[model samples]
Target: MEPNATTNENLNLYEKAENYTKTSLELLKLKTVCSVADVVSTLTSKIAVGVVVAFFTLFLNIGISLWVGKELGEYYYGFFIMALFYLIVAIVIHKTHHKLIKTPIGNTIISSILKEKQN
Candidate 1:
């Protein structure tokens, strides 16, 4: 091959390698974004789950209130009972947040973030 042709071929290979490197970097960045997004999605879904559980708990309280009202013949006492139930549920959820973090997926995400920070 002529000297000029050989130089052109080398330049072409260099350009291709640079392009590949750029693409790889872009993919890594995308993966990092996705990882962060996964954490956020998990957090948002957990919030939605907590809301659903709370609503169901409230429904149970309402049902209990209705039942008790029928038995005691006083609708107002049921409100007090429901309040107590709400208080108990709130306390239980507050106490178990750390416990929930021990689940497999949660632990993985937490460990990943911690590792990232250490690096």
Candidate 2:
């Protein structure tokens, strides 16, 4: 009877440990899903905004380029000026992209993933 009681106790302990492990794994999975969803949603919204802004800028530039060409008496002159301006801007961005773009974007993603839920 004593041996039987001890065996039953051990079995109960094992079952409790198994339950704990399964619960822990489920919690981990939930947290992972939450973090991924947060990151994806944040990125999706930003991309949408970026697309809208890009279209607006495209039309604005085209209008400005045409206007400038009209004023300059040659349509291509306005485009050339705009192209030169963009070339310079691109060169500057290329030089500082790591500092101005990459680090900030990386930090934003990391923060989104690590940010705790409010509720």
Query: TM-score of each candidate?
Result: 0.55, 0.93
Q: Whose lDDT is greatest here?
A: 2
Writing each residue's lDDT as its tens digit, candidate 1 over 1-119 gives: 69999999999999999999999999878768867987888789888999999999888878899888778889878877878877998898788867764576667787755654455
lDDT of 2 by residue, 26-87 (tens): 98899889999888898899999999999999999999999999999999999999999899
Off by over 4 Å in 2: 117-119
> Each model's number of backbone clashes?
0, 0
Q: Which 10 consecutive residues of model 1 have the lowest summed lDDT?
A: 110-119
Residue 35, model 2: Cα distance from true site in angstroms: 0.7
TM-score of 1: 0.55
RMSD of each: 5.5, 1.7
lDDT of candidate 2 at residue 46, scale 0 to 100:
93
Q: In order, what lDDT does every prediction score? A: 0.82, 0.92
